[model samples]
Every structure is written in structure tokens, then in C-alpha cells.
Target: MSQAAGGVGKRIAKGSMWLSAARLVVNLSGMVSTVLLARLLVPADFGLVAIAATLMQIVTSITEMSLSQALIRLDDPTDQDFHSAWTLSMLRGVTIAVVLSASAPLVAHIYGDQRLVPIMIVLGCGAALSGLANPWLAVFQRKLVFWQEFVLSTASKMTNVIVAVAVAWYFQSYWAIVAGIVGMYAATVIASYCILPRLPRFSLASWRTLLSFSVWTSASQLVNALNWRADQLLVGKIATPTVLGYYNVGFNLANLATRETTLPLIQTLFPAFAAIKHDKPRLAAAYIRADRLLVALGVPVGVGFALVAQPMVPLFLNPKWLPAVPIIQAFAVIFGLQGIAGLVTPLGMAMGQVRLLFMRDLQVLCIRLPLMIAGAVIWGVPGLVAARVLTGLYQIAIAMLLAKRLAGVSLMRQLRTHLPTLISCCAMALAVWWVAGTGWRLFAGYDLAQDLVLRVMVGGIVYIGARVILWIVMGRPEGLEREAANMVGKLRRRPA
Candidate 1:
């Protein structure tokens, strides 16, 4: 490898480390807050918020320009680019605020719930605040040095959790959920300017340049959001608010693992890929490695969570949330598959193939919207979630084609990378099942809490044991042995 390639590799490694640390901090706080809120509040509270949140997401996504990505893709960005992007953002924010404010009452009336009116309006303001955040943050991603991004993202998450918990304790209503949502964006906008120390000017000198790049991305974002939020939309529309809340709980819990683990790595890849987009060999290599890495991490967590859902649910959540247990199990596998498939979007974008990305999402949206709605109408929340698994398969197939066309990464190569990880995870699941069944038979008197803790411990040990054996059998592919050996060498050389 050239010195340049080595340097990029080092930067990617460092950036990933920082992002992982940031996700750890954020997810810990989020989990604690979720536990407290779930105990103190009820499903209806969450459902009420989801009603307004769904609308706000649609509006924001429909209008999003993805200016940050455009900026990041540029090899050399200028001050005018920043100013123009900020200008576009300001206009977009105002538009979202106005549109959301206007549509709030209609949405509330449609749902026959007047409470959503104020919540929708408030969420609009939050979206606007998000629009005002510093564009300089993109520079961090562009350079693959995300220390400031870490600080900004972590501070916002911490602030969000703290405020939400305090509010929920006081109000015991959906207002706590609102507070968290708004607080996170406000915190991000404040920290963005402070950390980057940039005063964005209102200008449109680079408008044409940015729009040319972001137009397709904007379409993709809109369709992507529709597909992403289709289930929530369907649930919120057909089911009772309380039912929607239960579904939301399951969805959120399942998604939390993906967001914290697979998402951080995927987010880092866009710029990393862009840096080497012109080099097909290097880009393909990185893509394969990343695919293997995400599968190795995601499969175990998904399968483990699915295995222990029954015990874990009653222990961590209130009994009222027991309805979400099955939903959680279904989505655990879905999210695991999604983590592997979701890589195609950023990779496509980095290769300047946003049009392909947009088309893929559009195809899914056409099929997914009707499918989710029918499922919800026919079988309720569980059906809606099951519908998603089918859609996920469709997406994975499309992603495989995109990988082949854009990166020359064949499906066989992809399967080769994922095969060992998949096999090891299956072994781990079997081990966990055996352990849990044996423990249940022996300790008939154990409560859910004790059972959950024991099962989790046993699952972790089994999974690690299976992974180690597989690693040796697969010749320690994807650099696991090398990374471990390097760490050991560093430990030996340390002064301590």
C-alpha cells in the first residue's frame, strides 16, 4: 500500500473509534432515559408523540437538500459553498416551519386528536433549529477527523436525555417526549456554532452548484424517509394511539441497536469512500471489509436479543409493554439484515450514483407503502412489522445489484464475507437457546430479572466462544487477528 492509502486507513480507524465512543455515551444515556420514561409513563404517551413526529419527519425529509453530503463529496470546498448551503438551509427551515404549522391542525383533525396540534407546531420549530446548525461540521467528515462531531453529537444526546427524564418525572405525559426531541436539535445547533465558531452568511452564490449535486439526493431522501417511516405512519393511522405507542416502543428498541452499532460505521464510510471513489480497487476492498465487519457485530446482537426477548422485556420494561415483546423479536432480525443492506446507500452516493440510490428507494416505496398499509389493515401492528421483513429482502437484492454495477463487488464475494459470521451467529443462537432452556428447567423459581441477567451472560459467553472458533477456522479474515496482535504489542511496550 502507498503512504497515502496507509494514511487514509489510519484516519478511518481513528474516526471510527471516536464515533464508537460517541455512540456509547449517547446510547447509554438514551437507554437509561428510555427505562425511566417507560416505567413512569404509558404507551399512549409515546403513541401521541409518534403521531406528530411522523408528520414532521415526512415534511422535513421531503424538503431536505442533503447539502452536507454535497459539501462532503467535494475535494475542496470554499467559503462561498458554506455560505450558500447555510442560505439554502435557512430558507428550507422556514418553509418546514410554515408548512408544519399549517398542517398541524389538519393532522390532528384526521386522527381525531387535538393534542397533536401543539406538538406538531413545536416539532416544526425543532426542525428549523436543526437547519440552522453549522455547516462546518461537514468538514470534519470530509477530513475523516470527527472529534468535534463526537462532541457535538454526544452533548446533544446527553442534553436530550437529561431534559426528557426530568420533564417526564414532572409531567408524566407526552410532553417529556416532546422536550427530548426539541432539546436534542436545539443543543446540536448551539454546539455546532460554538465548536466550529463559524458565522454563516446569507448568500446564494453557490446555489446552482449545490443544487445540481443535491437534487437527486433530495428526491432520494424523501422517498427513503417514506419507506423508512411507512410502518409508523400506517400504525399511527389505523391503530389506536396506545397500540401505536407499543409498536413504537418495539421499533425504537430494535432500531437502537442498529443506530448505535452499525450506523456509526456506515456514517463514516461515505467520506472514506468518496476519498477513494476514483480508485475502484481500493473502494471495493473497503466495501467488502466494512460489510464483513457490520455483519460480524450486528448478527450476534440481533440473534441474542431475539433469543432473550421474552425474559428481557418484562425485566426492563413495565408489564404494560409485554405486548411489544413479539414485535421486538421480529424487528431484531429485520434490523440485523438492514444493517448489512443499508451500506449500499452511502456507497452509491460516494460513487456519484445518487440517481441509482433514488430509484431503488422509489421502487421499494411503491411496494412497501401498500404492503405496510395492507398488513396493518389486515393483521395490525405485528403484520405491519412482518411486512417490513419482506421489504428488507427486496432492498437487499437491489443493494447487491448496485454493489456489482457500481463497485464491481459480486454477490458471491459478498456472501463469502458474510458466510462465516452468519454460521457463527447461528451456533451462538443455538448455544443461547440450550443454555436458557436448561436454566429454566433447573431454576423454576427464578424471576424474570434473574433469568434475563443469567441468560444474557450465558449468551455473551457462548457467542464469544463461537466467534473465536470461527475466527480461527476462517483464517481470521477481516483483520481481527492483526488488530488483536497489534493491541497486545502496544500493551507490552507501554510504560505501565
Candidate 2:
């Protein structure tokens, strides 16, 4: 790499740090607020609000296709680019907001719930303002100024929690929940306005150029919206609205860890990767490096949560939501593989293979929707979750191919990087199951607490010991050879 390119790499690395930390802070806050909100509101309230949000989501997904990734791929966008993009966003904002606000009564009429009209209107306002945000946020990302975007995103999300939770505490109604929604978009607009760069005048050339992608991207958004929210609609239309609430809450909660961790990686690294598409070797290295890092992070977190879902769920949500427990666990396990998909999606677009990526998602949605509907009819919420989990396995194979073909990183190389991670997940699952089977009861007398502590201690020792041994045996822990050798010496000194 040249000195200039090396500087970009270093800066990308630094920016990745800021972006990752911002995601961590924001997601953690959002998770806490979810727990609190679940406690404060009734299932009906959550259900009602969820329906409105899902309806808005179906719409929001349709409209959001134009901005981020398209801008990322453009090499050297001009002021005309900015002017046209900003105009596109503003126009979408007004159109979507009005459509949502107006459709409220119709939605209420369909769902037979008169209360949803105002809620949908509020959500529509949020949708409207969301379209008004930093077209330059994309520019910030394009320039590898991911940290600036990170700061704006994090601060905006925190505002959502503060406004939503405070209002919920006093009002204890769905409107307070709506306030949280309002606060989030309000924060987005305010932060983007303050931090993103000033725009140039609206230019006809730029308008025409961006319009090409804007239209297709919007179409992409619609397809994605339907495919993404298919489960919510199926569950709501077929199952009880309350069941849909439980289903969405559980699904979103389960996905939080993967979504939070991997999203920033995509946002930061896709632009970074796009900038280096001409350099195959550099692109390959970056892809492998990112794949390894993501697998290491995502797999363990997902599996560990899956294993420990019992205590984790009730600890966060009320027991009334116990039904969501198994569903959440299934999702966490499936989503853990999402890190692999994360590497694929951006690598695809970076290499101009996004059409393939879209086609793959299109396929998944086609299979997944019918199965999800069948599952909702038969298995109810868990069936919907099972369909989602099933999608992951098929997608992983496609992700592997994309990794190899697009980035020149072989599928074997990618799997080799994650072999230990796979082992670690299995270890966590086995340890949790063994400990759980031993009936380490903890809700009883003092004995229960003592038994619980013992279970955790033993489970940790066994799980970690197995992973360390496998890591050594597989020759994947060469980087930790010195530490392993020292541990061997210490073990030899013991009374055996």
C-alpha cells in the first residue's frame, strides 16, 4: 500500500473504533429501554403500538432504498449529487408522511381498532422527518468519516430512550411509546442538520444522475420491506395481535446483538472496501480480516445468549412475556450466523454484485413467507421464528460463495477462520444443556443460590476448557502459543 492508502487504512481502523463504540453505547441503551418499556406497558399496548409500527415499517422500508449504499458506491460525488439527493429525500419525506397520516383512519378501520389512527399519524410524522436527515451522512460515510455519522446516530438514539422512557413513566400509555418514536426521528433530524455538511444548490445534472438509482433503490426498498416485514404481517393477520406483539418484541430483542454489532461493520467497511476494489489482494485481505473479526464477536455472543436465555429473558422482561423466551433463543442462534451474512452483503455491493445479493434475498423471502404463514397457522409464534432460523442456513451457503467470488477470499479460508468460533458455540450449547439438565435450581431457598453459583462456575470452567483445548488441537491458536505453553507447564507442575 502507498503511504496515502496506508493512511486511509489507519484512519478507517480508528473510525471503526469510534463507530463500534457508538453502536455499543446506543444499542445497550436501547436494550435497557426495551426492557423497561415491556415492564411498563400491557401486552395489548405493545401489540397495538407494534401493529402501527409494523404498518409504518412496511411503508418505511419501501421508501428508504435511495440514499446510503448508492452514495457509498459513487466514487467522487459532486455538489449536484448532494443537491439532487437532498431534494429526493425531502420529497419522499412529505409524500410518505402524508400518506401515513392519511392512511391512519383506513388502517384503524381495517384492524377494527379506533385508537390506532393517532398512533399511526404520530409514526407517520416520524417517517416524514426521517426522510429529511443527512444526505451528507452518506457523504460522511463515503469519506470514511464514519465516526461523525456514529456520533450523530448514537446521540439521536439516546434521545429516543430518554424521551420515550420519561414519557412512558408518567403517561403509562401507548402515546408515551409514540413519544419515544417521535424522539428518535427528531434526534436524527436535529443531529444530521447540525453535523452534516452544507449542501450546494439543486443542480439539474446531479438530479438526473441520482434519480436513476433513487427510483430503483426505492423499488429495492419495497421488495425488502415486504420480505423483511412478512413475518410481522403474517403473525398479525393470522395469529392474535397480542401474539404478534410478543413475536416482534422477541424477534427484535433477539436480533439486537447481531444487528448492532454487524451494522457498523458494514457501514464503515463497505465504503472502505469500495474505495479499494481495484486492488484485489487488499480487498481480499480486508474481507478475510473482517469476516474473522465478525465471526469471533457474533457467534459467541449469540450462542452464549441462546444458552443462557432463561435467566436473561425474565431478568429483562416480565414473566408475562415468558412465551417469547424460546422464540428469542431460536432467533439468537440463527442471527449469530448473521456476521457471516454481514461480510457477504457489503462485499457483494462493493464488488458490484448487489443484484445477486438482492436476488438471493428475493429467493429467501419467497420460501420464507409461505413457510412463515404455515407456521403461524400451525405453530403460532414459534413457527414464524423457526422459519426465520431456517433461512439462516440457506443464506450462509450463499454468503460463502459471495465471499469467494467477489473478494477473492476462498470459502475454505473463511470457514477456517470461524472453525474455533463454531466450536465455541457448540461448547456453550452443550454446557448450558448439561448444567440445565442437572437441575441447578435457583428459585428456592439458600441452597438454590449456592447451587446456582456452583452451576455457573462449573459450566464456565468446562466450556472454556473445551474451547481452549479445541483451539490448540486445531492449530488455530498459534497466536497464543506462548500462553498455551505456559499453561501446559503449570498443569505439569500439578500433583498428576
lDDT tens digits by residue: candidate 1, 401-457: 888888899989988877776776777778777877776643556578667777788
Model 2 lDDT tens row, 300-381: 7676666666666665687788887787778887888877877776676677765676777777778878887888788877
**All candidates' lDDT scores?**
0.84, 0.74
Query: Where does model 2 exceed 4 Å of error?
Result: 2-5, 197-205, 214-217, 439-467, 476-496
Best by lDDT: 1
Clashes of each: 0, 0
Clashing pairs in 2: none
lDDT of the structure predicted as candidate 1: 0.84
lDDT, residue 399, candidate 2: 78
Residue 97: error of model 1 in Å?
Answer: 1.0
